[model samples]
Structures are given as C-alpha cells and as structure tokens.
Target: MTNLYTGCPKMKEMDGRAVLILFIMLTLVKTEGLVSVTTGSDYVVTRVGENQTISLDVSRAGGEFRVSFNDSTEYLFHKFNNSDLKRVNNNRTLYRDRYRVRGNITSSVFRLTLYNVTTEDAGIYECQKFEGNQRVPGCKQLLIVARNPSQPNITGPASAVSGGSVTLTCSSSSRSLPPDHPPLTMNYTWKRNSEEIQGGGDVSVDGPNLTMKDISREKAGNYTCQAKEEELKSDWSARHVLDVQYGPNTVHFNETHDKVTATEGDPLTVRCSADCNPACTVTWLDTSRQKVTSGQREAVLSIPAVNRSLSDLYTCHVNNTHGNKSRNLKLDIQYGPYTVQFNEIDDKVTATEGDPLTVTCSADCNPTCTVTWWDTYKQRVTSGHREAVLSIPAVNRSLSDLYTCHVNNTHGNKSRNLKLDIQYPPSVKTFSDISINNITRKVDSVSFLCVVDGNPKPSVYLRHDLTNRTYPMTCETLSKSIYTSHQYYECTHTNENFDVFLHGAYSCRAENTVGHVDSRAVVVTVPSK
Candidate 1:
C-alpha cells in the first residue's frame, strides 16, 4: 500500500524511531527532581590549627542520588540527605539522569580534627546532575584562615622591696569558629626586659600566677608575659618595673681615736662611715646640749681651754637616704681641788675648865673635801664643834694663847688664827673684930664677914685639916645676899683663870673655855685665952 510502506529498509528506520521515543520517556521519569546545592560565595575563615565544616545541599536530587567528597584523599567528610526523592512510576530504572555532590574542602573538617590545620583547606563545593552529556550547578566557596589570640592583661607591682615576693598573671580571650573548630589552647612565658628568663631558678609558674621570691636590687627590671598558640602568638603585655631598696651599711664611729685622758683644752674628732644611696650627713652635740649640723660624714669638736666645766656627753648622728643611725661618747676634763675661805666669829672664848670644846674644821680638794684644827697646846682638835676653852683658879694675872681654825673643800685647804686671853683679879672686904684682924679666940662665938669682886662671880670654901673635907662658906649668886648672921662666912673673887679671897684664909676658883685656876689656901685659927 504505498500501501502501508512495507519495505525492509523502511521498516528498519521505523524501528529506530520507536526506540528513541522510549528512551525519551525513561529520561522524563528520572528528571522529576529539582537537584540543587547551597553555600556562601566567600571562603569560610577558621583559626590556625582549628576544625571547620563544609556543607552541600542534595535536596533536589532523586532518591537514588548520593554524594562524594572532592578531597577524600587528604581529608574526608560524611554527607547526610533529608530530601524525599522518588521514581516517577515506581520503577527503579525509570530515571536516565543521575545527580551527586562533592565538597570543595580547603580547611577540611576531618583533617583539621586529625592533623594540625594549616592555611590550606579552603575552596568551592558542588552538586551536579547528569542528563545524557548535560550537567547542573554547585555551591560557591569556603575559606579557611588563621587568627591570633588577643593580648593578655597583667596585674602587680613592677618593682618590689628586697627580700620580698611578687606575683604575675596572664589571661586572654578570643572569638572564632564553632565548637568543631575550637580555638587552640595556649601557654604563657615570663620575661625580664624582653629577655627570656630560662634556667632562672627564682622564677616559677603555676596556672595563671607567676612568682618571683625574695627579690633583690639585681632583680629589679621590666617584666612581661607572652602567650603562644598553635601557629599564632599574641603580642606581649605591658611591662612592669620593679624597684628594690635597702638601708645604709658598714656603720662606723670616729671619736677619741685612741683611749686617753686629757685636760680642759683638748680636741675631739667624730666620724661615721656608711654605705648609702645618697651619701650621709653627720651632726655633733656640745656640752650645753646644742646641736651642730656637721653637713659632712665627720665632725671635729675642740675646746680652746679644757676645764672641769667642759666635761659632757657627746653623740654623733648620721642620716642617709636609706635611714638614720647614731652613737654616743663621753668626754672627761680634769682640774684641781681648792678651798674657798675660813674664819671664826670670836678672838677669845672663856669657859669652865672641865667643859667639852668644839671647833669648825673644813677643807676642799679636787676630788675630796676635808678639814682639821689644832689647839694652842698643839693638840688635834675635833671639827664641827664651835667652842674651845680652858679654866684657871686663883690666878691674879692675865694669860694668852694661840688657837687655829681651818676650812677645806674641793678647791684647796685654808687656815685662820685665833687668840685667847684670860683676865682674873682678887678682891677683899672684912667684917667683925676677931683678934682685931684675922684671928679669933677659941669658942669665943665671934662674928666674921667676907666679900670679893671680879669680872666673873667668886666663891669661897673652908677645909678641915684632919679630914681634908671642903665646905663652901660663901658662893657668888646672880644677885648679892646678906651674910651678917652666919658663923662660917667668907668671900672670894674669880675672873676666868684666877680666884682670890677677901679675908680669913679662904679658897676660890675661876674657869673659862680657854683655862682654869685655883686660889691659894688660907687658914683661920681660934686661940684659947
């Protein structure tokens, strides 16, 4: 039939056409999905030695679609699919198009976890579908980068006193990748003036605090702590300076270079030596407690004329930048002992013969004070007692002698002269005619009277020959009295050294501090007619 064109060659062409149609139908079934992948266009940044994630979207891919990584050899990652892709007619072989995904791993997540990450893992990722010689799109790019930790803050003194301890600390914080790409942990080291302190036995590190113990002047300097992380380190923190101080040393005193004794006019030297940051100043003290700034390390004190009054206590005071110190010294000046003066109020003293005598004895000496005296008889006299005397009885003349007074003190010794003279005279008066004078008859009962006058009052006494017993016939009273009726009545006179009788043999006595005297004996005998 033109007849329904049944030629063999023609038939062959018809069969090829039908097969092409069937192939097209099968492609239609598998192409139902919208296969796609998403990622940022810029490379993702990750700190050095940190893990980073690279993602791909397989949502549009058919159920049979799977993923493979581009960097599986150097680093690898797992891919998860959440899309619900299916065959068009439930025929497993219906789809002729195939799709897949690959990660452009630069800082590969797996390698970052395994090996220390360098700056290399960053690139683009892709999701592709093939339709018989035709392919689809992919995600853009991922970037990996290295970042440093921030600088740390430090706190504490830069300089500390000698023999003291100090603490140093370092801390830092950084913001970077996710948990999978945790920042690198770091270690810190301390330095003195930017120089490493390795092998320094005094330095010790514990956690965040660093300690330097018993610092000295040599330890004074600037200090810093540096933090280091994998492939990256932060700048050093601010520096702190340490200063140590100590007191003056090597103390010395200069005074009396040698031990010796000197008199009033002597020179003295005082010098103090010490090591100080600023040099030292010295001061001197005088006898009157006056202070003189030496302005130098030493001082000289000279006395033009040395004397006992110049003796005093001296001291040296030293002041330095660090502190002050001092010492004391004593100066002794010698002189002689001398007495001031001595004298007595009276030239002569009259007293009873048996009475005690007192005299003043005073003297002076450089180191001691004393006094001594002597009487006219050259006898050592007692001191401090003022009176001296001797007595005489029945002396009708005057007597004189020499006495002495003395004074002594620290200065020197001195003496004074004194003279004592005694005056005594006899007087007489008579009453009654017994034998017409000094005689009376035995048992006659004759009356007799006697009187005497003298500078000192007088007394009379009578003595019996056999018994030697003496009895007072008349004694001087402050006032005169009547003795006309008395049988045994007689008068005598006394003046210091002598005593005298008035009538009929009578005895009397006189006395003074200087001497004593006794009157001559007289007898009155009665005659028997």
Candidate 2:
C-alpha cells in the first residue's frame, strides 16, 4: 500500500487521470510477476449474455488482495483491492458494469462474479495476496472461456418438385472464444420438426452441409440446427421451412363405394376432389365423354331424372401443370322395365308338340329388374330373375296359351305378351260303331262316318281290309267344323258270309304335314253259321 503513494503527489494535489494511470501501472507489474511464478491453473466456461460465478481459491492468498484479468498479453486489465475498491474510486467503471466482488475487507475467502459475460471476457485471470503492502507469494491462474456465436442460419431451396434433389447448409461464427484460449471450435447437428436426423441414402451430410435426394412430399417439415463446442452449445437456429411442391397425388370421390345410384325419375348428384400442393383442377365427364365441370378444385354432377339410358360410366379428372390423373365413376340409375318384348322379334313362338319349349322375356333396367311369367289365366308360373324363362320339358297343344312377362321395380312396372303356338299331328274319331254290326242280306245301304281334328285339316280316307288298300277316298271336311273331317263307307252289296261282304273291314286314315293317324278297324260277320 505504501508503494501506491511512494513517488505520487498528495491525493488532492495530483490530477485524477494521473492517479488512475499510476494505480493501473502498479497493478500490472505485480500481476506480471505473479503469473510467471504461479504453477497452479484453473478453468471456467460461460455463454454470452449469461452471468458466471467463478469459485476462485483465494484461501491461500491473505491480507490485501490484487485481482488482475488478462488475455495472455503484456498489458493487464488492472485489478480489484479492498480499500478504495468503490470508495474514492475513479476511472474503474469497467469493474462496476462487468464484474462484482463480495467479501469482508479483512477476509481471504473472496468470490468473483462476472455480469452479462461477453465473448471478450474469455481470458486469463491472476490473483495475488499482499500483507503490509508486500507480496505474500500465494497466487492463482484462472482461464475464462466464453462462447457466443452468431445465430445459426440455414440456406437452401425453399420449395421443389417431387423426385427432385435439395441441398441445405447451417452456418455460424467460430471465433466466439477470447485470445487467452484457442479459437472456439464448433460442430453442427441438424433436426427436422424437432427430431434429430441422420445422413444416409436419402440424406447426405458432410460437415455443415446437408443434402437430400429424390425429395418427396412426405419429407417436408421445419428444419433447425445447433452449434456445439464440447459441453457448451449455442441456442437452436431459427426454423427453416422446406415445402415440396407437387402435382395431385390421388383422386377421391364423395360418393360411397365409388359409385352413384338413383331410382328412376329421381335426382342424382356426384362430387369429386383431389390432394395437391397448389390446389389442383378437377373435371367431371359424363357417359358421353363430355365435360360437365372443368378447371375447379372440386366438381359436381347433377341429374334431374334417372333412367336406364342414364346408367353409365363417368370420369373424374384431376390435374396440374406437372401431370394429370383420372378415375372412373359408375352411375347405377335404376328404373322400371323398358323395351319389353318377346324373343326372335316375334310375339308368337311356334314349336312342335311333345318337344321341349322355351320362351324368354326381357327388359332394360338398372339393378336388374324382377321378372315373372304369367299365363293367360293371370297365374305366376315362372321364377323371378332379370329375364323370364318359361320352360316346358314336353309341350302339347293343351298347353298352348298366351303368356305374359311381367316386370316390376320400386319405381315402375311393365308387361309383355308371348303367344305359345303348339302344333300336333291329326286326331281322328269315328261316329258309328261297326265292330258288332250284323250285316245280313236285309242290311243294305249301311253307312260309316268319321271325324278328324288337327291344326290344318288333314286329308281323310277309308280302307277295306280285304283289298289291303285305300280304295275309297270318301272322307271330306265337315261343313260345321273347319277342323273336322268325315268319312262314309256305304254297304254297296250285302253278302251272306263275312268273307263275301264289303263290311268285312272298314277303317279311316287322317294325315297332315305334322303326322298321320289311323282309326279303329270295323269287321262284319254273318249269324248262325
């Protein structure tokens, strides 16, 4: 303490500036000697804008104290001592804003606390003890390390098309440390959406630069980076958003089961949309391939009334300048039966009797119409299906009738007629019984008649057994019945014996294109032979 005023003028006589110079010079000389002779060294780490309380070991140092801060240079940052520390202090404003020391003036256990530490504060610190204004030999060597780097920034393409490549980089200053210690060393780590990311096939990392290949929409998110140096680290960088521009990925329909359904004479509506980046356009096409809506993100198709003709395919197309896609939508328009008619374009179906017969009835409708076959008597005889099949294993003329094909839906109904015409061979019937006839000499001029029935009147004939031939062609169609034919064989000559009479055997034959039939034979005999 005597050395501070040994050669200096009285405190009131000297200029304040000169007094400060002398004090700082004296502190520097003492600190220089203490650092060169001190063998113990300590360390401290702090972040910028943060306060650090270094627990310096001043227990070895006693009495008055001298604290000096340095950056390993010839000059010293000056000092802090017990007396005149704040009392009558001048030009020591650096101590008030950046540092504060607290302890009893006579105590050796003192603490140093740095306020709002900055990058420039990283340096060496020296502490020397004194008693009776002479050096005590106790000393300490402290190293302060400060880390403050510029806020990390990420630069890269803000947006890109799918399947394209992308590159990004994180940058910050590395000279955050002071001159006392080595330059600040930093390593970079990247994260996306707050989750750490590694480098591999899809992503490549080299130092601070990160690259991504074949980028897709699924890989888009917010990215950030951090600068790290050993245990010290800087705050995370500002978020850099990566948006991948792409065309419409897929199309979806608002309708259920991807289909539109409506009953006959009812309204219908269909809607479609797509997923894309820049809001894609949509187009709705009808069954005729004509656009119903175009150049919109969403589209709708409306129909006032629905029918079988309106049941068809529709298309929903979504597109952008990059590409386009289309999906087909089916409109199942339901309705009652229509265009009802029989098979072969004829209302009548002609078939031979005793042969299999089949008749079909159909109509155009959506959801397939419920069909039934009804006979002329209004009897439902056929199974229900899209089309009616009236099947008969063996058909006969008795089964011929007019059949109706009836179809019905919740919306409407319709009916069609089909005539079943069954044709058969001629059927013959004889009127008189000649098998028991006793034709004697008195029974002259006896007659036989026959009738034949068929679709087309068959030609009728009479035959005699004795001649074994159709000798008499006397059968003719009846005047009263157009389908009937008659035959008469008169007994021209009476005979005494069964063998000598014309009544020995008589028969009738009826024939048409379909087939032929023969009637029962008649025989005559004499009594009391």
Candidate 3:
C-alpha cells in the first residue's frame, strides 16, 4: 500500500492501520489552518510616550496561534505563542519591557499592547495559527505607525528695527528611539497671535527657518512654532514677542491747531509731540537753529513777551534708537501799527490843479493795521487794513490841504502827514486903465496896471502894439492869497517927450512856470493937443 503521507515514504511498508492514524493527524492539521485573524482597522497609529492596544480577532481557530510583528521591510520584531509571549528577532531585547500581549489562548480576541511607544515599534503585525513553522496567507496585517513629535523652540532676536530683516529658527530636542531605528523626519509650522502664518509677501519659511523681511510695526506680535512627525503634532512652543522699533512717524502740536499766533508782550506756549516706538527724544529749535532743551516725546516752547524778533520757524526734532524725524512749527508774533508811512519817496505830494492825486498808506502790524485817511479837519476820508489809498480826482486848491494817514491796531496807533501842493497856470485878472478919465492929452502921465493869479507870483509885463516893445513890470502879492497886483508899464510925455510914443494898444501878460495869460488890449490914445 502507498503511504498516505506524501513526505513519509518509509511508512509505505507499514501497516494500513498506522497509515490511517497518520492521515487522521494530517487532516486535523488542515482543519486548524482555517483560522482567520482580523483587527479593528487596517491601520493603527500611536504617539510616542503613550499607550496603545491593537485588538486581534481569530475566527474558527482551535490551536495555538502565533502573533508576530514585521516592519515595512518584512523583518520580524516580536512574537507571541501559546507557551510564551516575548520580543523576537533583532528587536527582541530592544522592546523587551515596552510590549505585552493580553488574552488567553482560548479566547477569540487578543490584544497587543504597546507602552511608551517609540519610533522603532512602527510596522505591520501578523496573527495566525502556526502550521509547523509555516505562516498562513489569510493572516491580517495591522500596520502600526509610531510617532514622536516635539515642541519647537523659536530662536531669534526679540526686537527688530523697522524695515530690517529677521530670521527665526524652530528647533526641537532630539527624540529618543530604539537602536538601529530609522531617523524621524519633522515638519515645522509657524503661527502669529494664534493665526497660521502663510509663506509669501514679507514672510517666508524654509523647513525650520522663518524669515521676516521689511518688518514694520504691523508685523510686531507674538510668534510660536510647532513640530510634526507623520500624523502626530506637538503643542505650540513658548511665544516669542517681537518688538519693532522705529522713528517718530508724525510730529505736530499736541493741540488741534498746528500754527499759533500771539500778540506782542503776550506769553505763548507751544506743545509738540510725536508717534514713535521706544520713546523719542524731542527738542525744539528756534529760527537761529538753537536747541530748546525739553523733555522727550514732548517739547514745550515757551515765549514770554513775544515780539517780532521771536517770530520764526520752530523745529521739533524727534530722535530715538531707531531713527530721527523733525517737524516745523510756525510762530507768528503780532505787533504794532507802526507809525503810518507812505510808500512814496516823500510824504509831500505835488500835482497839477486838474490832475488826480493818490496817496497810499502802509503800516507794519501783526493783526494788520487799520488805515484811515484824515484831512486837516480830522475827517475820515477812507479806511482799510494794512494799506489804504486816498484818491482825489481833479484835485483843486480845496483838496490840497494837510492830509494824514492814521494807522491803528490792537497794539498801537500812529499817524503820518502828507502835504499836497496844487499848481496852476498864471492868469491875468484885470488891467488898470492907462487913459486918464477916459481921455489922454499930450504930456499927460500914462500908466498900465495888471492883476494876476497863480500858484506862485507871476511876472507881469505890458506890450505896446504900435511901438512893438515890452516893458517889464513889478508885482505886489496879496497877503495869504495867490493873486498879485502889479504896475505893468508906464509912459509919460514931458517937455520934448512926445505922447505919440505912448499912444498905442496895450495889453497885460502874466508869465509863470505853468503857463502865461494875456489880458484884453486897452488902447492908450492922446486927444488932439
């Protein structure tokens, strides 16, 4: 009879009953091969320094089952059987006290517990009935993923100047792992004020290094870093506060108004301030570039009894550790209506009688001076501020009087006089009679008289038509008047002197710088002697 066991050729000569017993034993071994192993899921993940249990279920199993763990390389690390549960292979002693199997061999469910898991314990685990050292193909694979994450420590400058660059390095303490275990790769993430920081713009990241370019006050905040390995994440690291220092951005008066005005002899105070980090040193400078020592961040420029000399540009220089900045403050000091003055070369004005006259008055004052033109009678002719013009059209002697420009302000008042001189052409008013009693006889004395009016006394003369001769004459001015009386010419016939020479048409002429005027002719005739 042929042997029922294929590998037992020597048993071919044995008894058939013995062959039947051997076949029964082989059949029992095949029946036990139907054992199926399963787990809760296909994958298992656990963090380092934590405990995790992988539950296994075996279906229809009636024999001793062997459980073993294999890495991604299919290398066995641990094994458990009905008789004993222990680490095996190269990691046997490495994970000696870190792993345990809980459950009786007769139970349908068994658990593989990992305590204080490490990176080296991550791999696939197989549980199946052992068939004489052969692993069953139906065994389930439990992929265990062990993770070790670390809290990242951020290292960089706590303070940075605005517009500068800074780099923060996220570092972590080395993780402890089993001997001969693969190295753990870690990833880093950055956060600011609890918000995730994205790469781009002024911020960029490379692995564990984070760079911030062109930092500003807006970039100042609390920053933190976290380190991750596989699916395990660590807690956020301690916050690193960034302080951005800068200059005094804007400087101006603390008051609402930027410019201030003060009257002469009045006390004035100007307060200046600036916006800056790390506090700014503020100093006030006068127009002369002299520093006004004061406190930092604010400077009070005080002026006691401000005058025109005190009016100038005041600078508020603000300086800090970051940079420097300055602002200009204008100080206006108002003063008098200084003595009313004329822009003309001289205050005395001369114009023709029929011409127009304009007299402008200008004054120096802080709040602008009020100017008024007053005549000798103290009557207001015109009023204006700073400057005023008194215009007289076709001015005559009546308008030619002592005119004064009065300038006044809150500070003081002043007056300036302007004398107007009016000039006109000479005029012949009247001519005295040259005939005696409307009749002239031979040897009778004859004379001619003329009256003239002009701005200045004019020269009077008489012209004889028949004789074609002119006789210069003398004049007598009327008191406080522009008129004058003069004897123009005289002709007398005495003895051998004939009256024929004196008998002629005579006229009077008055001449001056302006012009000359001639009077109507009066004939000097001698009756028949």
Ranking by TM-score: 2, 3, 1
TM-score of each: 0.31, 0.52, 0.51
Model 2: worst 10 consecutive residues (lDDT sum): 21-30
What C-alpha RMSD separates each model from the true structure? Answer: 20.4, 11.3, 12.5
Runs off by more than 4 Å, candidate 1:
1-251, 255-260, 272-274, 286-288, 340-518, 521-529
lDDT per residue for candidate 1 within 51-94, as digits (tens), equals 33334333333222322223222112221122212222223221
For model 3, the superposed segments whose C-alpha errors exceed 4 Å read 1-152, 174-181, 185-200, 226-236, 256-258, 277-281, 288-295, 319-324, 342-360, 377-385, 389-401, 409-529
The C-alpha lDDT values of all candidates are: 0.43, 0.61, 0.64
Q: Which scores better on TM-score, 1 or 2?
A: 2
- In terms of lDDT, which candidate is strongest? 3
Ranking by lDDT: 3, 2, 1
**Per-residue lDDT of 400-506 in model 3, one digit per residue for the tens?**
36788888888888988887777777777677664454343654456667777776456777777777677787666555422211212222221123365577688
- Candidate 2's TM-score reads 0.52
**How far out, in Å, is residue 200 in model 2?**
7.8
Per-residue lDDT, model 2, residue 114, is 64
